[model samples]
Target: MRVHQLVVNFNATAQKLVNWKMIRFGFVLVVMFTLVCTVKSYTFQIPVEHDKNGEAYVTFDGTKHWLKDNKNLEYMDAQNCTVHLELFALPTEESNAYVSGWRLCPQEFDKIP
Candidate 1:
């Protein structure tokens, strides 16, 4: 009878451990989903080209600026006619650079969409 009781207790403990692991996994999944959902998505329309020195260049409202190769543009925000620009790294195995963000010039504030 003691052996049977011991076996039952061990089984209960194992079941509890399994349940705890599953709950932890579920919590992780929920956290990940919340993070993914809360991230804002943005789209950029800047043109990227290479400069004479082989560095990447992006054109913002016709003004060209050199950028690091293999980066992506991240959009920050526009305030008082200044458009902010951010850069994100390339996610693929290619030789392309992208604008991570953009800041509109104060002069062109009326033309922004």
Candidate 2:
């Protein structure tokens, strides 16, 4: 009878100690962690440099590619081991402005073209 009463008292105290707000916050953190992991697994973004005479360059790991001429504007999707590239830049202010500096873009978005 004493053990049974102690068990009931412990359960009551445990229930009172739990805060609903803390549980809700923990749930949100789990969701956000999952979302970040899923996206990172499927997409890769690497910083790249641009050069004159129409060229873009990236030296990831220990590889160096002096990509020029026909392979000037190119992106190698490290996720799928595929290369998607653009041969020429558009002849407009907005389009030219975007590709003028070093940048990072998800390889999947550039994978289509």
Candidate 3:
């Protein structure tokens, strides 16, 4: 009888430990999923406008960055003024000039069906 009681108690304790671990794992998963959904990526877009001299300028983070690349013009022309900017690891001298990293979103992505 005593051996049976000890076995039953051990089983109960093991079950409780398993339940506690599952609860902790579920809590961690929820926190990770929330962080993934809410955290913004380094990539974002800024408005591009042409000045009177036809120079391209992008307003980023409340600062106006004048672009000086011919590729930027080609991108703007190709994307019909829609462009996505990816920030570089190191800051450049041209303020927010459109350097190498640029992504053009598909036009159909925002289309209303």
Task: Please tell me which predicted candidate would have the highest lDDT against the true structure.
Answer: 1
lDDT by residue (tens digit), candidate 3, 20-106: 999999999999997665433323455456667666666653555566543332234354544444333223344444433343455
Compared with the true structure, model 3 gives a TM-score of 0.39
Between candidates 1 and 2, the one scoring higher on TM-score is 1
TM-score of each: 0.52, 0.32, 0.39
Which consecutive 10 residues in model 3 have the weakest lDDT in total? 86-95
- How accurate locally is residue 81 in candidate 2, as Cα lDDT from 0 to 100? 48
lDDT of 1 by residue, 55-93 (tens): 566677556655554444434334444455554333432
In order, the Cα lDDT scores of the candidates are 0.59, 0.52, 0.56
Model 3 deviation from the true structure expressed as Cα RMSD, one decimal place: 10.7
Instruction: Report the candidate with higher TM-score, 1 versus 3.
Output: 1
Could you give the C-alpha RMSD of every candidate to the true structure, in order shown? Answer: 8.5, 11.8, 10.7
Report the lDDT tens digits of candidate 2 across residue range 1-113. Answer: 99999999999888866766679889999999988875556444344455665555445446544434434444544454443333333343232232221223455466754
For model 2, what is the C-alpha lDDT against the true structure? 0.52
Model 2 stretches with alpha carbons more than 4 Å out: 1-18, 47-113
Winner by lDDT between candidate 2 and candidate 1? 1
Q: Which candidate's TM-score is highest?
A: 1
Give candidate 2's TM-score. 0.32
